[model samples]
Target chain A: MAIRYPNGKKYTPPNSEVKKRSIKDYSYSNRGKTLEDEIDEANDFYLQRQIAVIHKKPVPIQIVKVEYPSRSAAVIREAYFRTPSTTDYNGIYEGYHIDFDAKETESKTSFPLKNVHPHQVEHMTVVAKQRGICFLLIRFSSMERYFVVPLEMLQNAWTRMLTGGRKSISLVEFEEQAIEVKPTYSPRIDYLQAVRKMLP
Target chain B: MAIRYPNGKKYTPPNSEVKKRSIKDYSYSNRGKTLEDEIDEANDFYLQRQIAVIHKKPVPIQIVKVEYPSRSAAVIREAYFRTPSTTDYNGIYEGYHIDFDAKETESKTSFPLKNVHPHQVEHMTVVAKQRGICFLLIRFSSMERYFVVPLEMLQNAWTRMLTGGRKSISLVEFEEQAIEVKPTYSPRIDYLQAVRKMLP
Candidate 1:
């Protein structure tokens, strides 16, 4: 029987040929990976070196039906993805509570405010109030530029939007207010160096 | 088709009659709820009051198959429960990074060492080294007693067990090393008070 997702999309297992092709494509080109993948690689590197212990929170799901196919394996037969209440990444680094979300955009001129959810903004505000280091890692994929924008600046932009201002943050504002994070070979994205500079 | 859990137990949705009976039973008896439930309620109270931001990390699951049944929801058809790499609860309180797990035992004389997992112990150790507050909220349900045992004390007990010592921590040791946490109405488990006493 064919399986169905909550979004009414049919689930088709990737064929071996497609899998092989994708693997070859990814191995040959940096364009194959998303910004989130690069950040995850960086997190793994940081963890192995004991430099930091950050982790992306797992996607939350609400399970309605589960089937125990064996004594040790439970297969979820019905479940829905739930909206996450907080940002993607959070952990400790140098005794600081670190929390952030990585975002990618193809546009080079401005980042759309719609990319960020209001609840996430509220969560960041709360974390910051608790003295945690909260920020966003935004990737301008078209320009190949990455910036670490602190929660305060994001909040300012959000407020401006609420007051009938531009609905996006311009590249000019990003250059002035955000810290640039250069890409690296080993860790992939060394955004922490930018974070270290932001720390008081 | 009937659903089942990883343990091979059949999953039955609680009908309204069963639910009503359970609610009445719980309303009249203190035996109905688990320690974890009380702690969750307490965390909710704390969050509602803006006193703390602690949250129990959702159980991690490895999704193998998902099907779209509708445009708005994706139903997972096959998934397995994954072992979590860290403790259950973590968040910020009073500018401090707090990480802990709540454990309940029916033992009257001693808490069994088997209840704590090796990976969880290692995680607590790492968090402590990072200067984050890490501990175990252990409840002797039989005695209706809860204690906040610091990672240091837990490490000591684990080490003793490794050296062929008793496989459980005696109540006497708890009196000397652990801080007692009293239950309250709103924040069902006021563990932070115990945490405050542990802080320098």
Candidate 2:
């Protein structure tokens, strides 16, 4: 099946071979899927099972030229994708206000600060002060390791970087401060169990 | 200044005269602004004052074409706006998980049930079950009345309608069950204060 965009343009899937290979090999099920894709699948699992209702905020777009082909159908001829002003995923989990972004890094030794935007950092800071559950789901893709770093820890690192500190959080520091989330067949990345440990 | 899409196509703003007129009249501040826009501005006010961190999820778009006119600037030539799979606004407020949709109707006596989609109702139901705060910010535009109708109230009406009841919720029913929220200067629709009233 040919994947096409709304405007009838063809959309090429990123990694078709790897996606096919991963489905066949259960051991490497998590290999082909991107961190965001895995998290989305996990959220779907959670929603279907009535466990949680987290969702990734849609990418903001500025629509300019919209053609009404029919009375009910509006076709967008032009639009601009805008940067998100907040974190990606957020929802309720057992009465808790959960807010976080799922990020992936190729670096094995450190998670680069550049991967996160300043606005996101500021947003998370405010959310934390409001007593909401704010954290980062950082996945070191090369090493197949995932960590749930709390807002406070991220703030400390962010503050340090702004004041002439390291641009990245070292793996050593992540091991001590962040909670590791192991992958599962159903939820994919079962970070909520790790989140439970973070609650006061 | 003329508005243009990323594809360099001319863009027309909705309700241009009302928008232009509203900019001049300070007293009729919320005149031209849609309920969603008013809520967005209110959310901004809340965020800036450190009162809450609510946000409307961006409308999802399927991008089909892009034109790179320059090395750094990528222009979206074609896209399609998609119907949201979830509610519009959601966030944390004083340790509460807030989720809702802002809707406007010109009808004076009753608010039509067709304004609320099935997926949104389902989403709200799930969020309510998870113990998160869920409701609807309904505006009777002609009557200049606004109400925060809880998910339970909405559910009751929805169930009745599904079982061949009235297609609309009467003003009497709204007065009995829903919490009236008047428009204000800072947070245009002060629904959070009303939400606080609903909490135990």
Candidate 3:
């Protein structure tokens, strides 16, 4: 299967079957399912068993222009992101409040710091202060690896940013602290299992 | 002060002193804001004070076509509501999860039953079973009155449908059970005050 970016450029998934599969073979050839689609599928699976209740928060958009062509339909002609939102997903899991962001990086060596928005990091920090489970699902597309990095590691990365360090998180550092998640068809990416393992 | 809907439709506020006052009127004016604008303002107000953190869930839309003008922007050309969504707003307040739907009815005598969808009612029933606070914010636009009617009342109304009852909720019943919310500028709907009153 061919991988394509929004730019219409054809790309190759890391550890493709055409090449020798690595220990971190987590890339998907499916073209129809987006990152959000996979996450929602996983959420539905969790909900069915009464395991967790989670949802992706809507992107807050300010509709500048709307065309009501008819009485029943209102079409937004122009809109903009209203504010820097809190995170991608949040809800209750096993009697604990869970908050997280899902991010994809094509870098093979490290995930760029620029991928982590300042406002989102601040929001995750607040979630941590409230004792909520906060983390990020980091997808290394080039390495075909996925890691669940806790909010503490993210905060530490942010602190390093203030000191003018490298603009990316090295894969070596990630392997030491981040928990790896194996992908499956039903739940898509069962990162929660990694989360469960991390939990005391 | 002038009263208006978010889309700039003019109206007289419930108790407006000015014949054409903008800021002089109480809250619930749309002279300068839109429906989405009011919901955003209300959510921010709730979050700031650690009050009831309510938010409008995203409208479930099935996008059939997208017109990508640039790499950073994509315009949805065709979309439709996928399924009947549960409610407009939901969040946590003080320890209880609060869920509700807001609707405006122009009929002074009765609110049309057509406005409430079967799926939303079903979602509310599930929420109720989970011990969540579920209700509806019914606004009699012409009468300038708003009420928070519990799901139980709505379920009773649903049952009455089979017996061939009126297809609308009478104003008398709303006046008896629905808590009237005097809108404010900052918090807009100010539904939490009503929530506090509802709790035992």
Candidate 4:
């Protein structure tokens, strides 16, 4: 049995150790899907049941050249990825405009601030000012746990990094400020429940 | 002098006659900008002023091949456009969810229903069901007129078309049911003014 801390979070190995475990561990199974996939599945579940209208925004690409083999078919010959200007997922839920991004980190102890872009922070700030529900759905992959952290907490973390404070949010801080979203089989990630709890 | 109809609208020339006027009029002027550009600039104006947070969702692209020459660079080699599953724009305005698509038509008499995609109508229906303020920003290019038509109006038109009715919304119908958005020097679309008027 693995040793656990007083709070019952199992000890996570170092980055090098975790990386080594994947050596010859290329399991091409559904279990290997990324955090993005899980959230997408959850969003799909929400959409089908009419629980919410949230959707992941499509990936933006800048096209430079196109080839028209026929009048009906045009293919992109050259293009580049455009950095998204806003959060990945946004839509209305019970008349509330909800906006958020999903982030995953292998580190169990802290979530790095570098995962979020400055412009995204600015967008979320404006959304929060509009009184819309804005936040980050962060997944601690190593611990197999998720948390719905509010935008205010993220803004504070951003300020801390700029003012030469901690560059990341410690697990203890998250446990204090965030609402844990337990993963389930059907919804995969029942984040809306946490959102409901967050609502006044 | 232009002939005015009963509603004070100037008589529009036939398409052939109107298209003939531009035989040598290849003007590379700001006036030649598309409705998409106008809406984008208007969105920028709104964003800079912190009015309402709305944005155009980017064109979705499907990637087939990419070349990463370096750790920091990725060039897309092959890609194809994917039909968007929702409207072109959506965001929050004064704590209300706003969703819409922009369409421009050369015809001055009617806005063709063929301009709207079936999936887009379905998506907007879901958004409206969720209590989002959804509509279409339609521009009659030749007349330099724009109208903000409610989704319900579009839905009714769609139903009528399917039930052996007109395949388009006549200009008279638009004038009666839709709000005409005056194009201005600043905020070229001034759509939110129309949206504000729309709010109860």
Candidate 5:
């Protein structure tokens, strides 16, 4: 339902097959629900306990046309999905601005750098520079493993790629740089607990 | 354009005239653009200067049906505007979690409580409880006056209304409780400076 690709660069739209494939990028097979669902459940658990307040921002869409059939219900007639400039989820956690993107890959060996866009990387860099808690929740879906990769690690990978380095972060690299988060029943994915461990 | 009213109490959305009236409520006579524009411009100014990273969250919508007529463009055939559960604008400023709602009224003497939904107030209360900087950017368009009312003041007014007190906050109270912000040429409304003054 969300388009992660920047229009001209990675994904040129009007290609039905490619678009369909992009949607598959977000869907998880093992779990009945997606990784987004796990994070949402965790957020809900936190909100209920007043432990933290975080939310996935709405998918940005450019509304071109609206039909006012009746005075009350204005149905959106035409809208185009817009690539988000910032991360998907952000909120206040432990009096700090928390910003992160949740991504999952089918690959067990490496998570492609292309999964995280250039623009999002730029936003995360600015956020981390501002001393906000910025990171990525990456899931190796095949291995059923999740890791919270800090923005510093992401920025380094992104910079290295721009300089003609490897275009993906290896599993071994993730194990060293990122903190692994274990999913639990009540909170689903307790990434915040992992966040606490990472913080000074 | 925007429905500030909650569904049951203030707004019953199948009615056309009330909906049209609500659209008019968002429009302004002077400056042409709404107060939302002023805030957006200010946010842009802040962003350009690297002062803050604040953005308005997208309007929540219940998408009933979408049609992909072409390979690229997916048209929303049927959709309903859902009320936002949280404050619209939020981001990081000097490592602080910033959250706020922008509101403007035609009334010069008072700001109506009916404009703020119970659910939004509940959300704002939780935000303030988390020690995130939370406030309301209220514009009295009739008098060309703007004020940033802290969440504590807003909560007090909301509580008073809920307890059978005045349904609106008087201008006199706003002058005393809220910090007045002057609009400028570049930033449009430099409320962040006002925010800094309010913060401990």
Candidate 6:
């Protein structure tokens, strides 16, 4: 099932005819790598140089069955997702506790609210109140751009969704507050420079 | 399949004949809930009052099929587990970086080394090298005892394991190095007190 796009349109599975196209056919595409793998490699690159300590939060899962075919490998045959209660990445960088979730959206004009969960916003509020450095690393795939928007902006947008406003953060508002991050091969999404400028 | 108990014995599923016992029959037992759920709840409790901000590092999973029944629910139909690169819990506790793993054993006299992955010990050492507070919250069920053992002790045991020594930490060693933690309802495992006495 496709999720509702930021523009309130249903997203359908791309046809196999379109899927056969090469990486050049898609915008902001880093070949065929999944989001988690790319971000993980990026974080490893950052950590190797003692630049920062950032890690992806594990997706919660409930396992029901495991078949042991061999002594070395036990294959999980059944599992279900558990609702997450917080944002993804969090750690200390240069003595500042950094918290954020990295997200990529195909929408052109805005990023949808549904892309973010309510608990994640709540998590941001708690982190902000504790004086932790918090933000969301948002990527506009169609535009091939990434931005780090402070927690306050996300809090406001999250509140708006609660009060019957549009379920997305407008591109106009994001441009006003977010610090742009240029994509790189080594770190993939180099966000520390933006964090430095924001927190310094 | 059941893992081996620390006492060099395999766990046979509790007799199927005893399945009808009431909740009080096993009130003191580590049943009715899984270790992961307990850790997750404990982390939530710790985060709410600003006592600590620990979270389980997510295990990487390879997703193969996702079925969307409706607009809201997406069910993961097929996936496989992958190794996690970091420790289970890592966050700032009282201004000091705290990282650890909570492991339970059915043994009465020792905790098995096989329960811990080698990479996890490596991760803990890295955290300790950075001067972060690191420890293991180990629970022995047959004895109904919980202990917080320092990472140094764990590293020593892990090194011994590589040399074909005992693949467990004996009760005598745990009694000396591990701080006893009395389980509670709110935090379940109140480990900060141990932190205060040790790291502080």
For all candidates, state DockQ relative to the true structure: 0.43, 0.50, 0.21, 0.43, 0.40, 0.24
Which of candidates 3 and 4 is the stronger one according to TM-score?
Answer: 4
- Docking level of model 4: acceptable
The worst-scoring run of ten residues by lDDT in candidate 2 chain B lies at B1-10
Fnat for model 4 comes to 0.83
Q: Write the per-residue lDDT of candidate 1 for residues A45-121, one digit (tens) a residue.
A: 88777777787776677878776666676677777688888887888887788889987777989999888999899
Could you tell me the TM-score of candidate 3?
A: 0.71
Docking class of 6: acceptable
- CAPRI docking class of candidate 5: acceptable
lDDT of 4 by residue, B88-142 (tens): 8998888889999988788989999998999999998888888899999998887
- Pitting candidate 3 against candidate 4, the one with the higher DockQ is 4
| Residue pairs in clash, model 3 | B1-B20, B1-B21, B1-B22, B2-B21
Candidate 3 error regions (>4 Å): A1-34, A57-84, A92-97, A125-133, A194-200, B1-39, B58-86, B94-96, B126-132, B162-166, B175-179, B182-188, B197-200
Taking all chains together, each candidate's TM-score versus the true structure is: 0.85, 0.87, 0.71, 0.85, 0.85, 0.75
Model 5 residue B4 lDDT score: 36
Candidate 4 residue pairs that clash: none
DockQ of 6: 0.24
lDDT (tens digit, per residue) of candidate 3 on A1-200: 23433222235454244356434543544333445666778888886766666677654444456556766866655544344456767666654567788877767888888877898887766555545678998877655578999988888888898799877789999999889886776677887998886554
Candidate 4 wrongly placed segments (more than 4 Å): A1-30, B1-30
| Best candidate, TM-score | 2
TM-score of chain A of each: 0.84, 0.86, 0.81, 0.83, 0.83, 0.79
Q: Which model, 1 or 2, shows the larger TM-score?
A: 2
State in Å the error of residue A190, model 4.
1.0
The candidate, 4 or 6, that scores higher on DockQ is 4
Interface RMSD of 1: 3.0
Estimate, for each residue in B1-200, the C-alpha lDDT of model 2 and write its tens digit. Answer: 23433333234345453545544455655555666667877788889999999998877777777776676655677666677899989998888889998877778899999989999999999998888899999988655689999999999999999999999999999999999987766667777878988885
